[model samples]
Target: MNYEIIINSIASIGVILSVIFLAYQIKKNTQASRANYYDSLNKTNMEFLRQLVENRELGELLEKATSNWDNLNEDDKRTSNYLFIQLFRHWENMFYQHKLSVLDKQLWTNHLNTMIGYFHHDGTQEWWLKRKMAFAKDFRDFLEKTEKPKQIYPTIKDLTIKNK
Candidate 1:
């Protein structure tokens, strides 16, 4: 009887330890996954910036499109349309990531502010109105409901100008 009781107690302890170990592993895996996601997101952002920096014509087109879409010729308008599509697609991905808790709240807030800043421009708003259906319904609804920031943000052209 004594031996049987000791065996049962040990088995229960073993089960508890296994449960603790499993929980720790799950937490670690989640952290690793989140890190990987952040890294990938950063890489994508860098690639976009790199493209703009490396291609002068592309950079100028983006500046013009954001500042005055109506001024662009037909071919430039088509190109700018595709550029906005890519930009919005990244924003949509960020939205879903934040919704899923994969992205940090502070980071999402910063990105949201940047998005709102873009919307402050007439050209950006125009592009969104025409292509909003290409994104997720929830994302579209969220953007539509968000109030534009009271302070106007600078455009790409403003940022590119030399201070001197």
Candidate 2:
């Protein structure tokens, strides 16, 4: 009878130990998952900030190029056109990747139209300056109109905040 009682006690202790170990493993896995999720969210937010700065810089460069139309040498003009085209393509790539807002796409389209308008009037350098100013105004309007989402979703916020 004593032998049976010892065996039962040993079995009960073993079961209790196994349950404790399993619970600990589950807790560790949960923590690791939370860490990974937060890390990923941080990386994404960083990328978005970086991309926004880059896009804004590109927009400024295009605006500068448009302003220099009167003084630009033929080669400089060609280079400017090439750079603007490349910027447009990059903007399109970002849009397709879902990294840019829809309003951004419309803003870029307005710039493209303005560029087309410049070339469309090939004969007259006289109207170039006026046309450029008009385009700039259109671009400013676009900037004023496009609004960013104030706060990301709670899931995104939860992931962004560091685990305690």
Candidate 3:
């Protein structure tokens, strides 16, 4: 009977240890998956920035539209609107992901601050104010609540001026 009791105790201990080990492994795997998700988002963001950097025409359109929308002709306005739609669509995805808790809080907040800076730029506010209906309602509400920061990012013109 004593031997049986010892055997049972050992088996119970073994089972408990196995459970703990599995839990630890699961935790590590979850962390790794989250890291991978963040990396993927970073890559997508970098690709968009790369397109802005490498393609001067796109940069010029964005620059002209954002800073001087009042001066663009009808064709330029349409083109600029198209360009901004492409840019902001990706941003919309990021915003939703953050809202769903897929993105880390601090990372999303930093991105949000950057967006506030963009909103404060010359013509961006006007553009968004008119085009706000195209985005998700919650996102539109978020933008409404966000106070535009005093400082804006350097315009695309500034970055591309060296190339010219």
Q: Highest TM-score, which number?
A: 1
- Of 2 and 3, the candidate ranking higher by TM-score: 3
lDDT of candidate model 1 versus the reference: 0.86
The TM-scores of all predictions, comma-separated, are 0.92, 0.36, 0.77
In model 1, how many backbone clashes occur?
0
The window of 10 residues in a row where model 1 has the poorest summed lDDT is 155-164
**Candidate 1 — which residues are off by over 4 angstroms?**
159-164
lDDT of 3 at 131: 89
Runs of candidate 2 exceeding 4 Å displacement: 57-164
Model 3 TM-score, all chains together: 0.77
RMSD of 1: 1.7
Q: Once model 2 is optimally superposed onto the true structure by TM-score, how far is the C-alpha of residue 160 displaced, in angstroms?
A: 27
User: What are the per-residue Cα lDDT tens digits for candidate 1 across 82-153?
Assistant: 888888889999999998999999988888898888866877776777788998999899888888778756
Q: Write the per-residue lDDT of candidate 2 for residues 11-100, one digit (tens) a residue.
A: 999999999999999999977765664465446546644653788754344444544455656665665566544443443443343333
